[model samples]
Target: MSTSSEHTFTSPFRNFSREEWKRLNGQLSHSIREEDLDQLHALNEPLTMQEIEEVYIPLAHLLELHISKFQELHASSNEFFKRNHQKLPFIIGIAGSVAVGKSTTARVLKKVLALLPSKPKVELVTTDGFLYPNKELIKRDILNRKGFPESYDTKKILRFLADIKSGKSQVTVPLYSHLEYDVLPNEKLVISQPDVLIVEGINVLQVNSRKNGVFVSDFFDYSIYVDADEKNIVSWYINRFESLRATAFQNSASYFHKYANLTTEESLAMAINIWNEINKPNLHQNILPTRYRADLILKKSAQHFVKRIKVRKI
Candidate 1:
């Protein structure tokens, strides 16, 4: 129940102030442009160029180092085996609460990493794609629990990661449409063997509750948790809902079209209701507990700018 700032810990993470973190960006060239930010920003979530330079540039550099290290380790293992082995993509897991802007972090990292000198291929996939189809959820009467872990096909996701780590040439994942708010039947995203793959979702950091089970994060070489105060996240979620009401929800085919014509007051009421009933409960019960599992934590200010970072101490 304690706020992020109020919570004290004797954990392995070392906290760095924003200024301290920025100093780590030394001599790293900024390759991201305004257009890139525009594309990466989620609804009602604006990312400033300064924030990207100060926060994400350094993050990209750190990831680059991890990728390089992973490659070297893989090569050493292959040499020890005296056999040629295919290089597998370095998987990065990004997790956070519902409105914490993890997707933007993932997309920005993908673009920046691709532009690095190595020109490594980077593909981004979201756990949303692994959610069971709406029809299946309805059939199971778990439609209200759509974003919960139980609603996801974890076995399938595990198999997908297994194939990727096994050096499969091509892997296909189901595509989920935000506009439709459902998994598109028969549509899949094809990911060729890449140098890096970023998986973003609200629950990516969660460990299986059952003992003696593996977690999706076990496959990740590095992981990030985008974090913010619960109050700020609730506000952001309402703002995003309002924005979607005016935009995507206006489409007749949109899943939330019923809310398109709602008055501002009504929209706000509904947003608050959804947050209290679903998102907040989910965050406290499932998401926040897993925050400690991440290799890096990007803690955000009320304005959504990353104010500090907590890196897991080696």
Candidate 2:
């Protein structure tokens, strides 16, 4: 593992106003239309088009812009070195706290980016696949901290990214099960020559892969951190838990089947317990610390609508 202290960003960013965002990303928003809003099961509630225009659509354009700029940089470098050219992979990382609508953002981004004629082949691989199996987490006495950075196979994730970024024709990403609460056997997602790769997780931009080690983010061409207040995120988490109690958790195969039998009061308490005991702490110590490291931060409100956007100033 190498320290990220040695790595540096390649461009500047600005916190644009809604009007400014429209001017800069308007063309992209039109070019890459996100007609169907993907469902983020964790959201606990239904989504609206307001979220799409204000948050996801603008985000798609911003991402598309960066991808093109990064591609140009590749060509620029090739010309500068007087070498034959090839298309370098463009990687985009989307990071956020638990229940912050990041999964939905990732899904919508995947669909929207695929709309681009210039870069129709986009791949999305979640960090969920990198999570340690339930048995491993239990052995390590960290099952409660599943979404924390330490729960992921960071080294393997880095290797996968490095391989694909290096122009390897095929890269296989593991699959994880929501019902079993572990990585699935004999199930993997394969990617090849992707024009854009969207990596979504709670700590994608966190630089501390180890005390001193290279982060998976080192390979990202751009990054977005979905953010909201602690109270709001906690509320969302609780609501989601209750919703799942009536839906997914009711499945007999669900590891959280016990939650389905709980009263609304009990379910809320359990969700908050999980948050306070595990998710919130992970956010404070590991995830939120990386927010500033992202190329852009999409700030949301209590209602889950994106309220503001912060782009890192060069």
Clashing pairs in 1: none
Tell me the tens digit of each residue's lDDT in model 2 across 1-314.
87786686555556666555544443332443233443432445456665555566667776777878888888898899998656767888999898888887777678667765464688888999998888899999988788877788888898898898778889999998988778997899999888988999887887776434677888898888988898888888888888788999999999899788999888878988888898888889998999888888877778776767888774
* TM-score, cand. 2: 0.87
Q: Per-prediction TM-score, please?
A: 0.94, 0.87
Poorest lDDT segment (10 consecutive residues) of candidate 2? 26-35
What C-alpha lDDT, on a 0 to 100 scale, does residue 97 get in candidate 1?
A: 95
Point out where model 1 deviates above 4 Å: 1-9, 28-30, 209-212
Model 2: runs farther than 4 Å from truth? 1-13, 17-20, 23-35, 38-42, 79-85, 117-119
